[model samples]
Target chain A: MQPLRLGLARGWVTWRSVNTTREGLANTIIWNALPLVFLLIFRNATIPGTDISVGVSLLPGMLAMLVVFSVMGTAYYLAAEREDGTLLRAKAVPRGTAAYVVGLLTVAVLDVAAAVAIVLVPGLFIVPGVPLGDAGMWLGLVGYILLGLMACVPLGVLIGSVVRSPRVIGGLGFFGITGLAAISGLFYPIAVLWDWVQWVVQILPLYWLGLGMRSVFLPAEAAALESGGTWNTPLTIGILAAWAVIGFVLGPVLLRRMARRESGAAVAERRRQALQRV
Target chain B: MATTPAGPAIRVGDLRMNYGRHEVLRGVDLEIRRGEVVALLGPNGAGKTTTIEILEGFRTRSAGEVEVLGEDPEHGDERWRAELGVVLQSWRDHATWRVRELLAHLGAYYAPYATASHPRPHPVDDLIATVGLTASANTRVGALSGGQRRRLDVAIGIVGRPSLLFLDEPTAGFDPHARREFHELVHRLVDDDATTVLLTTHDLAEAEILADRILILAGGRIVADGTADALARQVAGRAEVRWRIGEEKFVRPTDDATAFVRDLLTGPDGAGVVDLEVRRTSLEDTYLEMIRRHEHGDAAAAALEPAVAS
Candidate 1:
């Protein structure tokens, strides 16, 4: 029952996230709001029937990209807590890992909620009826974004389990997200890419999320597939399910090993070496 | 007659912790019996924390045997964790919650509030008062003075009222007054709950006052484990009787101070014995001597120093 350990860790992480966002607001405001402007403003002089002219073709991919970028932030929080002594404290508390995962998931869900309000709804508003055509279509839009982010849980846990330093994880953050974004067709459709590029993107999980998300928003006339390049929503979801299960199974095992690390000795040695340098 | 309990409450026999080729705890063997507050005294990197963590079940040993509450800590469960309260020196360093909130929250993790023996959360006010942090109860941990934060750490450790408490450098940041108060609190807890305490401290004075027995560790092994008086007898055990005689202050270590004083005052060369002070070897001296002797590889030879010097 001792939920306090979990509560405390989750609360601290949430507070840190809010602080980080507030500190970086000047940059985030520009980066976050610009896509909305492009979607609505560029529609003034464009063709109605064609996908590229009205920004509809770009809508699904952009939203998929938004989900990916935002979920990456939560993963960063997990890695940060692991590096800091706070995670070590949690390891000693009762009902430890089970309680901790519950708390982390709570934050993940809330973070994804913020992503929906910030990215999905606003982007849906700009693209007219295509992204939010009816009740069913809007529901699908929400569901896929949630599903895609949920699918990313395993990769996030794997990263959090293996990484020990915040600086290295932070340094990798941009490349990790953007590299996946490039291959996933966040800015451009994978269908328009060269043969080798498409092959590379197809195998990555991001490509499936992008494709599944696009299926909900764009009309059937949007992209012509190369015979077997057919979009399967169930297959997209299945891969995510596999990833989530793998994470659920391996996260604890990896964390158990990491938790056994001699935290005090490590901290003491680092502090010792640091003093020696001084 | 009260028969003293025999077996040690905690027994670490040839315990070893290894990280590849680096051995942190090199076969540490120690025992703390019932009704004893044994202070584990050592310098940094002497495996004090590793030993404590292994006993608390936070770390597993690479070799040897350990038993806390008669169960191996590495395999100890929630039930065993509930039996022992650990006041880690750095448990709450990164916390931002209020002092009171942190203590109360951690207390919930262990209070088997409905036990057939003693039920209910260990009184929070009692713990807060014991650690002398009543005034800083509501203060955010971030805003707390270092001493106050340490008091809260102590409060959190005993929130569940465990039968045995493991306090690692509990009063490191406390002021002199607060440290005394904390020592009294340990005594009070022991009296009230019969809590067997095992504290580790660098402050020898603290060990003298709070510990019924002191266990000195060096190179990951206990070199001395005995009552203050027994340990004091390790080096220069006899009292040094000093007195002013005419223009000279004379000093001599004597086993029988009364007889020596009788002889001094009754002899024909009788002189005035003013400012007379009888001083026994202190706990600090014994502890230091033990460590010195252990490091010097002359345990048998060095053990002869106190008696001969006397």
Candidate 2:
């Protein structure tokens, strides 16, 4: 119980530092700026044969993509901290690793929240016909975002625990997430893709996250652009919940295994290997 | 001096550690009494860190009866862990955290384990002052110099007020002033709180200054273990004496320098003797000699009694 409290304090400290530090602030800007620029470029352009502007349709997909990026960022930070001996330090204290993981998850949740706020607040002004006056739409937005995080964050942590080095996370995590986003229809409609490709993307959480976001943001008529020509709200919730269940069950076990293997010499060896790589 | 209670802070028997087919610690044995400062001195691959890590419960041993604070280190629980403080050779772990903040956060884990006799989590301000990092209490760890960062590591290590502290080369990269200050800090801990310390180091002088007993490890075994003076005397039994008579000089090794000097003055050649000098072997020489003898498989050197045996 004390460890949990300490973990909350740890999360608070890390969140404050990450948002306030110069490098951390810069990373947040660089990540969100690229998507904002893309949104502005297509603000006036409408989807072919539809009253919906490209910006309005792209905003929800962008939010989903941000969830994926936040998960990848969590994994990358875990691997890098392992290389830098932060995890080993945690392992030394009583119940330290438990606190460390909780702290990380807390900070990651807050980070994803900040990112969502950054895009959605500005998105209302730039995108035409945004349904801001509806409180129900805002509530749905909050629900899907929360559900999306529950699915993605644990999977990210599992990958972080399994990967041997930070370098692998950097190259492999980036390409893997980007590849999933492409097939999940983050940038375009999945209905326009091959039928087999659409089926493949449906199994992943990224697609459901984007679909749920679209359900809240896009008008009812815009549902015609979806693969099934409907929002399929029930399927979206089920798939995301299923992914969350698998992640929560598997994430803790793999994390414990990884934490058990950590020692001072292991960290030192990793640091040595990292230096040699440069 | 506030002597430690009548029990061993750490005990190990036939401790062996093997990585793949290669063995690192081979049948090593040691016992550190409560409140005693014991230094593990060895060459680069002498298994100092491996032994420390094993005792800290961070690594599993291949074959051993290892006990720290009356519990098997491999199975030490959170309560057991709260009593043990470990100072690892940290590089850049908590870079963005301020010194005081890190200590307080790390120390919070020990709050529930606090007892009436010994309170857990030393006050952040006091710990900062104890390690002489008061000025940098608010400074981010990344902004600290190498020496100040090492001091912060020490503060964090002792924040829980551990009864048994394991410091693996705490002063390795420290400058002379920082090293001296670190030694004084260690002394204060031992003297004031009766905290037992087991540190590893390549510096023989540091071992002599900080340790009540020194264990010389070579070839995966403790070759010699005793007080600094005791080990020096055990390995080299004599002091070297040199004198000049007329244009010739003579050098002689003696078990008793005072007696030898008196005998020389009383003897026939006493008047002619000039420029006399006596040199006793330092811990450094004894350390090097013991390591060399252990490597060469000398039977007598390996037969010396350890600190616990004495």
Give candidate 1's TM-score: 0.80
Interface RMSD, model 2, angstroms: 1.2
The candidate scoring highest on TM-score is: 2
The TM-score each candidate achieves on chain A is 0.79, 0.96
Residues A57-139, model 2: lDDT tens digits = 89998899888776687787788888788888888888998899888888788888888888888888889988889998889
Interface quality of candidate 2 as DockQ: 0.69
Write model 2 residue lDDT over B1-310, tens digit each, in one string.
1222566989899999999998888888899989899999998887999999999998989998998888898888887888888888756887888888888889888888787888888988988988888899888888999988888888888888898999999998889999999999999988988999999999999999999999988878887888988887663556888999999989997777899999998999999999999988767767776666656766244545321111
Every candidate's DockQ is: 0.26, 0.69
lDDT (Cα, tens digit) per residue for candidate 1, span A1-278: 45655465655554444435544444455555656776887554444556344566566666676666544555665665654445655555555555565566666655555545665567656666463436777787778877776766555656676775555666686687678777666556566768887877766667777777767766665544322455677777887667667766786687667666636445445445545766
Stretches of candidate 1 exceeding 4 Å from the true structure: A1-63, A69-75, A121-127, A130-133, A191-200, A225-230, A262-278, B1-8, B19-26, B92-101, B111-113, B123-139, B238-280, B297-310
Chain B of candidate 1 achieves a TM-score of 0.79
Report the Cα lDDT for residue A270, model 2.
85
